[model samples]
Target: MTLTLTALTSPPARVDLSPLVPETTRGRSAIEVAGTAIRCGRDRVGVGELFAVSGYGTDELVLRGELGRIDRIGAGMRGGRLRVEGSCGDHVGARMTGGEIVIDGDAGAFAGAELRGGLVRIEGSAGASAGAGYPGTRAGMSGGEIVIAGDAGQEAGAAMRRGLVAIGGRAGDGAGLRMLAGTVIALRGVGAEAGMGNKRGSIVSGRPLRPLPGYARAVRYRPPALALQLRRLRELGLEVPDAMLTGAWTRWAGDRLELSRGEILIFDEEEVAAG
Candidate 1:
């Protein structure tokens, strides 16, 4: 069974809808599911008051309408699938340990912050801190994968401890800020100061990127890891060019300010053209 929720009105303030995921709604009746409390502004309200809920007792959930103020849509989900047909607000899939969340439109800030496992795919752009850590925490996005088909705002993978974040479009400044571990692949250009303060991680840029002062170019070579990752991206329906899959990449290692194990790989245009 698949549950469907259609929002009747745009939320006035941030609404935490994490309580309505498959884990909590799987065995409940429509009335019970609708009665689930959601945080709206300073008050708690039944989901039935905000959206029309239909179907129940399933692991699949479909949500429609504009949810630009809905936060924590799939927080801590361990299994099942959630599909959003319209734009979603901040923290779309924060701390989800498993399952899948697909957003057909744009997502606001912290789209996948603190994710532990699972897959989150955004067909449109994402706001800042897409895979960042919670406030006061040392790590963000300990696991899972986030695929942004459009541009990503600043700090796309900030403080991520593990997992993968692939952006098919340009990434704003601070793409991998303070990243401890993980991989961030930006297909288009990346803004200044990417990989800042990174301790141990990999930032692969397919477009032009000026070397940051905190980094130092190490070498130029074709890494086997790039081929494997590109293949995975291709499986996700992302167009990974032949050159990118089999090209020499310039490796720059630094953010020497930290543990110094972090690396930034910039694709060599000349190699791309030759390929």
Candidate 2:
């Protein structure tokens, strides 16, 4: 089943989408209705005043027209697929624990903030803190995966405890700041202070880096786990360059200020000759 949403007019106030039924096990069990329509909510306004809802099914949900103000499109979703055909506001998949979300356009700040499980793929760029922990929260993205096809803003994966984040384009400053455990791979160059104060995690970059003074150059070796990581990225529809998957990486361990278990792997050209 497919539920299509077309905006009738620009919403005067931010619409609250919590009232919409979800595809949870209990919700699907109770509601016999397969599809629903929603429109911009105004002061004392009903859904009929805004947009027309059509379709009768539960398998798919599609959103059309501009949605720059519709926040939390799929918040805490546990099942079903959500497709956003246009750009959306912040918190597209906040704390989502299951299902898949594909955004065809750019997303606002905190795109996948504190996602616990499931997969979120963004075909366009994302704003700051793409997969970082929420403010005052101890953990960020404890599970699941986030793939950004374009450049990302600051603090891409700050304080992440688990899961994988792959940025297909360049990443902004503080890419993986204070990460406890997880994997962050940037296919393009990462911003300055890529992994500052990281405790235990891996930050892999496809470009060279100006290693911090405290980070000593470790032995250059082909990481056995890199093959698996790249394979996972490929499965997510990210373009993994042949050079990256087949190249050797220069390992630099640091943030001596912390556990010193975190390391950054910079892909090196020497691997081709050594092979």
Candidate 3:
């Protein structure tokens, strides 16, 4: 059974829709699902009052509307599938331990912040600090995968301890600031100051990159791990260019001010033709 929630109108204020997940509604009736309480700005309201809920739940959910201000759409989910048809507000998948969330439109800040497990796929762009830690916290997505088919805002994977963040389009400044451990793959160009103060992690870019002042060119070679990642990415339906799959990458070891174990791999398109 699939539960569908369509908003009659955009809520008057930002709404917290974290409770409307497949795990919570699995055994509930439509009426019970509607009765699920959610915070709307300073007031609390039931889903029934804001939208017409149809169908009982059984591990699948769909939310449709212009939800640019809504928050926490799938926070803390342990299992099941959730899909949003329109743009959404912040924290689209915050602290999720398991399950899958798919956003067909753009998502706001903290798109996958603090994700522990599971997969979050955003078909459109994401706002600042996507998959990053909250203020005053050193922890970001400890695990899981976030796939954004479009651009990403600043600090795309800041403070991530472990996980994979793949951005198909351009990334804003500070793309991997303070990264601890994880992998961030930028399919297109990345902005300046990427991987600043990164202690241990990998940032891979298919576009050309100027060597940052804190980094030193290591070598140009085909890393086995990178080849494996490219294959996996191709299987995931991401447009992994043919050049990247067989090309050499220029590795730069950097952030000398820190542990300097982090590395950045910039694809050398010239090598593809040379070969």
Of 1 and 2, which scores higher on TM-score? 1
lDDT of 1 by residue, 78-159 (tens): 9999999989989988999999999999999998999999999999999998898867888898999999999999998999
- In candidate 2, how many Å is residue 217 off? 2.1
Q: In angstroms, give how far residue 34 of model 1 lies from its true place.
A: 1.2
Say which prediction, candidate 1 or candidate 2, comes out ahead on lDDT.
Answer: 1
Clashes of each: 0, 1, 0
Error of 1 at 105 (Å): 0.5
**C-alpha TM-score for every candidate:** 0.96, 0.87, 0.96
Cα-based lDDT for every prediction? 0.88, 0.76, 0.87
lDDT of 2 by residue, 93-195 (tens): 8788888888999888888888888888999998888888888887888888989999889988888889888889988888888888898888886888888
Structure candidate 3, residue pairs in collision = none
Model 1 stretches astray by more than 4 angstroms: 271-275
lDDT measured at residue 268 in model 1 versus the true structure, 0 to 100: 70
Which residue pairs does candidate 1 place in steric collision?
Answer: none
